[model samples]
Target: MSANKGFETKVPENEGMDSGYMSGLVSELASGPLSEPISEVGSDSGKRISVSVEEEQLDSGLDLQISEQLSNLSFKDVTPTTQPLLVDLEEHKPSIIPQLDRLFMQDDDGDTQLHIASVHGCQKSVSTLIKVCPQRAWMDVSNDYGHTALHLAVLSGHDVVTRMLVLAGASLDVRDVSGRTPLHLAVEARDERCIKSLVIPSPNTPREKMVRILNMRDYTGQTCVHYAARAGRFDIIHLLVNCGADILAGEGLAGWTALHMAARAGDAALARAILDKYGAAAAARDFAGRSPRRLAARTAAAPAFAAHRRDDTDTDSDSEDDYDSESDEQESLFEKLVQLNNPINVV
Candidate 1:
C-alpha cells in the first residue's frame, strides 16, 4: 500500500546468468600455488648474508637503485693492528673523520662497515662508526638484502647493538628483503631485550606510531605475535599484548591465527593466555575451517597439561593416544567453554 515495498526486482541482462559457472571462474582465478619455498630466516651465527635473486627482483625503484650503488663499494674487516686507519677514528677529530668515510667497505653482501659491527655485536665499533661515518651512513644505507644495520643487530641477537641503534635514531619499523620488521625478527630470535628496544618509542617518536608498529604484519600476513607464538616466547607475548597487540588479529600463514600456531606448538599455557584475554579466538576458524578448540584438542601437550594438573608431576608423554580413548561424553565441559567464549551466546 505504501510503495510496493514487497515487490522484488531483477536486472534484465542477468536473467539467465549461471551462478555456478561464475563461482567456478572466481575459484579458478583465486586458486594458485605459492611461489617461494619455506626457509628459515635470521641466522644465530650472525654471519654475512646474501639475498635471493627473486627477493632482489621484488624490490623496485629506489631500493633497486641503492642496491646498484652499493654493489661497487667493498670493505674488508681489518684486525686492530692491521689497520691504523680504523683506530685513528676513535679520536673523532674533524680532519681525519671525513677521510674515514672514503674507506667505507660495502662488504660483498652490500653491508657498510656499520652493518658488520652491528651484526658482530661490537658496540664500540658501532659507536665509532656512528661518530666517524658521514651522518647518513650509520642508519640510512641498507644492504643488498634491504636490511639496515639495526635489522642486522636485532636479528643477530645483539641487544647492546640493538639498543644503541635505537638510541642513535635508527628506524624502529624498517623491513628486510623478506618484508619482516625488526620486531618480527626479534620475536623469532626470542630475545626479549631486543624486542623491548624496538617496541619502546624513541624520544622523538610518537606513542601512537609505536602502537601501529605493534600490530604490523610481514609479507606472509603474520604479525609479531605470530612469530612470538611460534617461538613460545611467553615474555615477548606478554610484552606485545600489553603494548597494544590485538589478540583477535587473525592474519598469518594460510589465515592461521596466533592461537592456531600456539596450540599446534604444544604451548597450552600461552594458548590459554590468549584465550583468557581474547576469548573470541576460541571460536575463530582458520583456512581449514577448524576453530582453536578443535585445534587445541589435537595437541599432545593439551593432554599432558591436563595430566599435570591432575597430579603435581612431570608429564613427558610423547603420544596423545590416551586422550583419544576418552568418550565424547568427556567433551561437555569443552563445549560449554566454547559457548561461554562466544560473546554472542553469553547471557
Candidate 2:
C-alpha cells in the first residue's frame, strides 16, 4: 500500500511537441473562455453587419419622428412668396414656418413683396398675397420712402392693382415721404383709372372717408383737385368734384384754391369749370387778397376771357354800343373789382 503503486504517471497527448510549449498553451486557454482574440473579433464580418443594422434602425426612427412633427403643423401654400421681378416663384414650392411673415419681409429699401408685385402689375401674385395675408395692415406696409403698396400701385399706373389694394382695405390717407398720398400721386400721374379707383367710394371705404382723403393736402398744401386743376385736367376736375373733392379747400401757403391754381396756370377751361361748379371758390381770396378773377387778369387767361366776352356781344345793332362800352369797362376793372361789389364775375 504505497502512493507510487496507486497513481501511475500520465504522459502528454501530443508526444511529438515540447512539454514547455504544451504547458504554456494549456495555461493560456485556462486563463479565459475559448473565444476569438480582440483583433479577430474586430475583423468578424457578422459583427460588422449587426452594427450597421443598428445604425440604420436608429436613423430611420429619427426620420419618422421628424415627419410626424411636420404632419402636425399647419402648412400654407406660399409658392408665390417672392419678388416677381427677380424670381419666378410660381415654380418653386419651398415650405416655411409661419409663412405670412415671409410675405411681409422687406428688402433693402423696405419694400415688401406686395410692393414689388404691385409695382410690376403682377396681379396674380398680388391676389395670392392678399388672399393669404393675415392682416390688412400688412398691405399698408411702407417702403423707405414711406410709399405703401397702394402708393406704388398708383405711381406705377396699375389701375387693377390700385383697385385691388383699395378693396383690400389699404388706407388712402397714408402719405409718402413727399407728403403725397396715393390719390395725389394718381392725379399727378394723370392716371384716370387709378384716380377713379382711389376716389370712388366702396364698401370698405365710405363716402365720408373718401371726402376726408379728397381734402387731404400734400406737404405743398395741394390736394388732388389742386393738382388736377394745375394740369388742366378738366375731366379729372369734374370727376373729382362729382366724387366729393373739396374744390373750395385752399392749398397750404398762399391759401390758393383749385380755382386759383387754374387761373394762375392760365387754364380758362379749368377755371371756368371750377367757377361754374363751386361759385364761392371764385370769391375765395388768397393770402394776398387776390381773388381767382384777379389772378386771371395777369395770365393768358385774360385774353381768353376778353375773347369770350366778345363772343357774347349782342347780335342786335341797337345794343352793340352798350355791349362794347360795358366790355371795355369790365376789362379795365377786372383785377380791381372785388366780389363784394361786382357780384361774382367768374373768369
- Give all TM-scores, in the order shown: 0.56, 0.60
Quote the positional error of residue 333 for candidate 2 in Å: 26
What is the alpha-carbon lDDT of model 2 when measured against the actual structure? 0.59
Per-candidate Cα RMSD to the true structure, in Å, reads 22.6, 32.5
Model 1 Cα lDDT, one tens digit per residue, 1-347: 00112432111223233212122222221121111322222323644223221221211112111122222322232121111111111112343333444435465667665665566565544554543333443475778877888887776676666766665567777777667788888888887767766665554335677678878887666788878877776567767877788766766444557776676666788876766666666656665455554555667546433432322222223345534434233343333433342424533
Best by lDDT: 2
**lDDT at 44, model 2:** 20
Off by over 4 Å in 1: 1-100, 103-105, 132-138, 287-289, 301-347
Clash counts for all predictions: 1, 0
Residue clash pairs of candidate 2: none
Query: 263-308, model 2: which lDDT tens digit per residue?
Result: 7678887777666566666567666565666557757665543443
| Model 2 stretches astray by more than 4 angstroms | 1-97, 303-347
